[model samples]
Target: MAVPRRVVIVGAGLAGASAAGALRERGFDGEILLFGRERHRPYELPALSKEILLGNADEPAWVHDENAYADRDIRLHSATAVERVSLAGHSVLDSEGEEHRYDRLLLATGSHPRALRVPGSDLRGLHLLRTLDDSLALRTALRQAERVVVVGAGWIGCEVAAAARSHGAATTVVDPLPLPLRGSLGDEMGEVFRAVHAEQGVDWRLATAVAGFTGEDQLTGVVLTDGTEIPADMAVVGVGAAPRLGLAEQAGLILTNEVPGGGVAVDSTLRTSDPDVFAAGDIAAPDHPVHGRIRVEHWANAKDQGAHVAGNLLDAGQPYRAEPYFFTDQYELGMEYRGLADPRHDELVVRGDLGAREFIAFWLREGRVQAAMNVNWWDDGDALQALVDRHAEVDARQLRSGDLASLVP
Candidate 1:
């Protein structure tokens, strides 16, 4: 048999580290080198804004230490980054002007948070939360500010608002959309989130767009599109993040189109146009088995996609297919969602009580189960997935009666 190829992975986040770990698990004796731009160990990002921000969890996010990598015989390089990629000859150039050659390369650079384009967005008190540094900076600024205005109704936006409220800061969430999580959970559930934050004493401003900033040096207030001025002590912008795809684009890789958000494109195998190069995490826009070519940014997606990339790199024989799955934790509430909703589905079945903070809603498209939302009752996730895969349709009564196991295929 031919010798195993060298594997070099970029971005040291969940995707990069998990990919390297999976490779060793699959008995790949090849030389594996993992590069991380950050000068620390790889840790989970989901807890950054929640547990880490609220001071509830203190353990490091890294699942393993340096000794683990050494034991596996994998090279883990920290405080280093791949400045550019020379696809013509499989290799990457680091920030120190050093070159490393590899037979297979995995790009998981992830993404950077999208910033506010307003004039005072660069003010000292203004902040964006995406990295550990951003979290620490925002945490400090929020403690000092008395009144805080948060822009955007996205997951991060709502989570930050909750965090700010926990710290006794007068908090307000302003979003152009009517509901905070309308993009992922649908408008109906979006209203649930709006009510949740409102009940917790957070100011929720819906269907309102920010016009401009009101300060010259530091953020003093904000201007709405209709000329409504709301004074603030500080501001946090959590709109979203733009995929870091400069290297991929420069390498002439095939770009995929994201309908609502602009993101990169890749095939089912997580491969760009260049066969040897693969991508995962936020930077990749692969065709979803159900959601078409859209990009979903969740911690689970990164871990799963990274595993797929690693499996495929072992040999040309194994190909990986991803099933979209994710979950969110806030306010002592756990919300789990599976599969993608079909745009054709207009009818929804509410099996449980949504108002009671415990319910399951299933989206149907052409008589097939497309997606589902499980609130509180987390045990039925596997049953829902099986029902979805089999396209089994049962009376809505069984779902509302807490007999979801009976609906399993």
Candidate 2:
């Protein structure tokens, strides 16, 4: 494969910005053009729910400064959305109706917050957290919100609930699930998270769906399916996120909508069906050597996959094998999880103390460690990750031995 003269990257989030930096670092002297739908330059999204919403930070975690991109010779177009992509013509059309040719194209378009289609979703005090501006706007509203209702028990919802309580709001989290984070962490670990939030004075309205919002011009209360109305002045809808794949779909790229990890389907090398075009971040569902085909929306995947695809863009011809990893912070609880495990079916074993919230929990299937999570327990990430990587069969008794090195075999 010949080196491309010009490379165009759509979406100026962490993945796109990381790819641009990796391209320059790997000695790619080609013209790099990065486009974003937001007015601000490329920044990390994790801080939006944590630091920015908590009023501990004023700015989004920028991936690179304005001058840094200029120094690297990367042309960044902020607030310029790529309206369409043409695989046959090898070009893309921006929102301004200008056509730009590219020898190689990378789609890191990321995902957007799933909307609540209830009746009063359009009310004044309803909010959805996704971008930097969304966080800032929600932060301003949270300050004066006396009663806040979060309509999801996922990471974003829990974090936003924590932020609301920090601001002295009577916060309540409502979800259809039986426990918080049950879909991801399963019931066993989800109970731990519920305890953490409950201890922080956050109320839970679980096992019930939201009927709709009640108010004329603004949100006054959240009505549950059982006809119980909880009084609230503010509401945040954070059920989950869906990958942005309109551009890729228009270009006729292969998608895996019927499969588990639905997104633009790519091969082992992160190359889409078109060959010349590639996808990464939350948009790319690549075939994994270890775990089959999967799509991860974590911050670690965006950072790692972006740089990994840069090498393949230069014809490195390597497959993506990075394990799934993510972290969450709410109140006094800080946790990191590695590997992918179906909590519903996997056998869970813990080391240390769950009551004290300082422990390492492992999810295993058929005696092999599938995933590991550490809550308020540091210094075991590398060892735990190694066990998962090796796919080593571990005895439940040995896992609680506090000696992770002995289980590597």
In terms of TM-score, the best-performing candidate is 2
Name the runs in model 1 displaced over 4 angstroms: 1-4, 258-260, 316-319, 342-345, 389-398
lDDT, candidate 1, 193-265, per-residue tens:
8888888899887889788778878889988887888889898888988878787777677776554455567
Alpha-carbon TM-score of each model against the true structure: 0.93, 0.98
Error of 2 at 9 (Å): 0.4
- Which lDDT value does model 2 have at 318? 97
Least accurate stretch of 10 residues (summed lDDT) in model 1? Answer: 314-323
Give candidate 2's TM-score: 0.98
Error of 2 at 184 (Å): 0.9
Clashes of each: 1, 0
